[model samples]
Target: MPPVERRDPEPIEAYLFDLDGVLRVWDGADLAAVEARAGLPPGRLGEIAHDLDRYGPALLGEVTDNDWRASVVGALVADGLKPDVAVDVVLDWSANLGRVDPEVTEVVAGIRAAGGQVALVVNSTDRLELDLVVLGLDLAVDTVVSSARTGIALPDAAMYEIAAGILAVPAPRCAYVGPHAELVAGAERIGMTGHLFDGVSGLRAIVETLSAR
Candidate 1:
């Protein structure tokens, strides 16, 4: 909701992105689509995923990856599906992931062309590399900082510090973009310019203007 700091007189020397909302989206497996794939009625997967108490730890890496899958499988099997079938559905859903936003891809590439540094700063599981490969937008940014591998998550100062360190840019010199206000707030807390995603139209214009500078 705040003004885009990319418009500030101080030139933004680098850019960083969040995973789920900004660049790589998990739209490939929304509740409706997963229901069709798992042959379960709508709202089943939704109920489980939104169950913060059960699956939240897995998502935040508090639980092991296997434990997370087991939790999902147990829920599916309890609903009368066979173990093998549940496993297949869960695996399929997990593996497919999401597609890259082309606008973000273009903006990142444009930043690179203009000699700006770009990085992917995300809090996710160890599948970060594979996720990037699937989205095929790893080519857009110069580096990535994934919490699954880094053992850090957003709203944590360490996560932002690690990303800025990897990019070899000071936090104040980097512009952080994400969908969540809280997550962007984390970056801002570290003195990075934080921008909430409004859509590609606004983001592209900012990207272009910054690169032009």
Candidate 2:
């Protein structure tokens, strides 16, 4: 990723970041076992995981956690699978919350130690915090702006605005960097310095761009 040019106002007061690709920085848990339990054809489990129509409500906090799990389990059972097998599949699916590169955590921790206020703004389900813990990442941020908790997803101006408010920082003084180009663009539209990270390596590029030279 090319270095982001610093623009307007002053050094950023807070940095709003994405989690999955940005912080996790790796292909997390393998879901092959979860698929096996559900007796799904290869790749079917991944498809269901990304089925927004099935998961959007859960991600938006419109459904309870158990209710959300039951939806997927129910679907599998209806697909000719036994009820016991369906529940087992969903239970196995929960094991792969995610994994984080400790190296990445150090980078964020370093930024925090240098006094950059940070907050995680991720589009995820209620398992976000659980995943964070499972990944062993000790995120030293002011607060997490979770779509599941806030009922607002990323790329929405309101999400970042609320995050800034929670961080007690001005909108323009906050910098947002994420993996999705659209989400970064969304942040840019509202005057926050927004950057798209290429991948794990791109993370350091981001830190350099934000550093005092």
The C-alpha local distance difference test score for the whole of candidate 1 amounts to: 0.77
Q: Which candidate number has the best TM-score?
A: 2
Model 2 lDDT at residue 194: 87
Estimate, for each residue in 4-38, the C-alpha lDDT of model 2 and write its tens digit. 99855457778888888777754423676567555
Worst 10 residues of 1 by lDDT: 25-34
Q: Report, for every candidate in turn, its global Cα lDDT versus the true structure.
A: 0.77, 0.78
Kindly report which residue stretches of model 2 are placed more than 4 angstroms away from their true locations once superposed: 1-9, 25-29
Per-candidate RMSD vs. true structure? Answer: 4.9, 4.8
Work out how many backbone clashes candidate 2 has. 0
Which candidate has the highest lDDT of all?
Answer: 2
Error of 2 at 137 (Å): 4.0
Off by over 4 Å in 1: 1-9, 28-30, 37-41, 53-56, 59-67, 209-213
